[model samples]
Target: MSTPQDINVRQKPAVAATGGGTSTILATKQLTKNFGGLTAVDGVDFSVAEGEIRCLIGPNGAGKSTLLELITGQLAPSDGAIYFDGEDLTGLDTHKRIDTGISVKFQSPHVYENLTVEENLRVPLQRTDRDVDRVLAETLDRTALSEKAETGASELSHGEKQRLEIGMAVTLDPKLMLLDEPVAGMSVDETDDVADLIRSLHDDGMTFVVVEHDMEFVRRISERVTVLNQGEIFRQGPIEEIEADEDVRRIYLGENA
Candidate 1:
């Protein structure tokens, strides 16, 4: 199993003027995904810099999830290429991707409902050679779940369960974490809490690519935004720039926004 040390993750990198880092950690060229006659993701080129939090948003069926699936190797791309940390991830399986410091927290909480919080962390740790006790402690504290260490996941609040799921991914000390609708179905306060946690983790040098719908959460979590439409990149830049576009407001944000 590979670890963060194996890849030499460059932390605290100098971010570019437009919210991108000097180094490109992940990139896809002409990436496309199709299901027979329906092309969900058209030919697209995307990139993410190291130590950056990138948000992907669009109206329904804009291919946000499909693009994420391609990166995680959940679904193979019909065309184009995906490169990560200077390695080709085309044929690599999801487990291999995790070994290379790529972990994901899907849209829903995926905790072991029957298990305790500490036990849930242990499952992912089984893949790593790190000290179990130390990781469990750190993950609990970082996720603000220390008090619930012995609590069953099914008993935790919705937000706490989300945190636990995120902690499960962070236990491996991944380099990049892909989150899909991480703040879904949460109160404003809970959503804010998740955003703060992500920012705190980013401060610790973990990169993130988040697929979210809540614009407020997106503004709070990411400086750069990528808007996809019709399986293609409609626009990408500073959050304010994307938000201020008239076409974007008219099409996705609507007149009231």
Candidate 2:
């Protein structure tokens, strides 16, 4: 595990592109989603680079989940286009999008409690062409569950369960990972452990698009922050700029601002 300083979690100048170089792994253009008379995700443009760790933060009802669902193909957008790895993904279904290197881990841990950590990993690995043993070992080491490989999912702590789900998501070797509230319900030490795991994975060339409300956790691992409000992008920049913005302070931070 590396310190925040050692991990390169500093603010950067504004840019139209993120990740590494000009490669955009995921992009949503004029993305919108509505439920009858109510709009959840209004027209919004969002993009993430190839190897960036981007955090999406906002208040409840800020359309964070809707936006994530739209991108993941769990819900269809009323209008808009989604592109991934330089191809259109707007009309693709959830499993199809996943087949193309887009994987999502929702807020809850969806592991098989009766299965061991390694067995849970095998569920997803069997779907891919990779060698099961090699990928399993790597995933265990990456998620810091190497010693707990044979432990049943039901026996693991809340944080360990979260890590197991993450490991399963990576079994297919996704190019872009959408993590919703990765640190939700985690203790201080657990959160720190997860953050360190995330950083370690990023260092290994993984791209992540995370939706998290925990500001301290966000500050721990984010290279950039995207602030969403009222179903749209209120602001997007480095964490420093976001923390300094008067409008963001007023709407999101409130008295703390």
Candidate 3:
């Protein structure tokens, strides 16, 4: 199993950067996904610079989850291509993508309810040098769940479960992480805590593509934001820039401004 001590910090590749390093760590060229008569995701071109926190947001049924599934290989795209670390990832399976240093955390926490918090993180500890104990401790600490380490997954609150989900993802030491509505249903305090954890990971040079409906949280965590509407790319740019665009506000943000 991977342990924290086994993490080869020097061997990890640098993430693509907005101005320097690699142009983009993850990019989608006209990616599309459809379900028979329903086009869940239209041709969408998306990219995230290394070390950047890119947020994907839109109204309900805007295809945010479908786009994430496509990028993470949980679902194949009907058309276009996906590139990661300069390699085509179109046909790769989800496990293969995970092996390539990509991890994803769903909006609803997926914990083994019968297990302890420590055991929860052990599921992803199978292939890395990450110390199970260390990762467990750090993750619990990061999520303010240190006291809950021995608690059963079934005993955790909704927010604690969410934190544990994040802990599991980090144990993989992924180059990039995709989080879907991480703070959904979280209390204000829990939301702040989760945001702090995200910032901490970003500071460690981790790349992220986050989908969220919380505009306040999005503005706080994202360096860039991508807006989608009816499965199409509505707009993408710096958070402030996207927020200020009139068309984006109307079509995606639902703002009169």
Candidate 4:
């Protein structure tokens, strides 16, 4: 697949870049999430640059999902704040967050099992004031689901279902996509196809923060990697730095390490 423009993943000086300049699409300041006494996510500061693909990885119960939940407004943060495109999002509801151009494709392919692929894409597109017919056609081609337009979602393979669900989100033209375990059960070829889809979309200026466990897939698509451990960031840098760190390797070995 083709590569995107070279990205400088290093931290940038905050010069009030809103949709331009450094282009940090999303950021969290001392973000935290707690369930009673258990702190699932500590005061974590995370950010993703626009037109970049960032991979979030770590061992089980590493607060990956919690952090995503906080960003997506699935779970309210116990502390800290969330910023998207220079607007405060910590208080917005889930739908409001979506309205601000943040779309999420959770681990499950939550497509309408009974609906055809085209119908499924139409559901989200029709909800907005966008030109449904025009965007639907574009989403089909962008998601590689053009041939499956008339196919029932239940009749599709796992990979196709994944693409359909992703297309559902793409219909509304989201600025940043947070994907959770996008290739959990796919075959080798299917995983590669998803990687290529992401790369193509990234080249077109879509930003992504993908939470995945597949190391091979992560390395293939990620310009930057963040390793979370026990609700705190353990490592953050290029994939090569994350891979070469002995501490990060041991952390993945087990949570207790």
Q: What is the C-alpha RMSD of each candidate to the true structure, in Å?
A: 5.8, 9.5, 6.7, 7.9
Off by over 4 Å in 1: 1-22
> Which digits, one per residue and each the tens of the lDDT, describe model 3 over residues 115-200?
99988888889878777788777877877788888899999988889989998999898999999999999999889889999999
TM-scores of all candidate predictions against the true structure? 0.90, 0.90, 0.89, 0.90
Which of the two candidates, 2 or 3, achieves a greater TM-score against the reference? 2
Q: Model 1, residue 132: what's the lDDT?
A: 91
Best by the lDDT measure: 1
> What is candidate 4's CA lDDT for residue 246?
85
lDDT of 1 by residue, 97-171 (tens): 889889999998999999999999999999889999999999899889999999999999999999999999999
Candidate 4 segments exceeding 4 Å error: 1-22, 253-257
lDDT of each: 0.88, 0.87, 0.86, 0.87
Deviation in angstroms for 36 in model 1? 1.9
Where does model 2 exceed 4 Å of error? 1-22
Q: Looking at candidate 4, what is the lDDT of residue 180?
A: 97
> Cα miss at 216, model 3 (Å)?
0.7
The predicted structure with the larger TM-score, 3 or 4, is: 4
Each model's backbone clash number = 0, 0, 9, 0
- Kindly report which residue pairs in candidate 3 clash with one another: 2-128, 2-129, 2-130, 3-129, 3-130, 3-131, 4-130, 4-131, 16-50
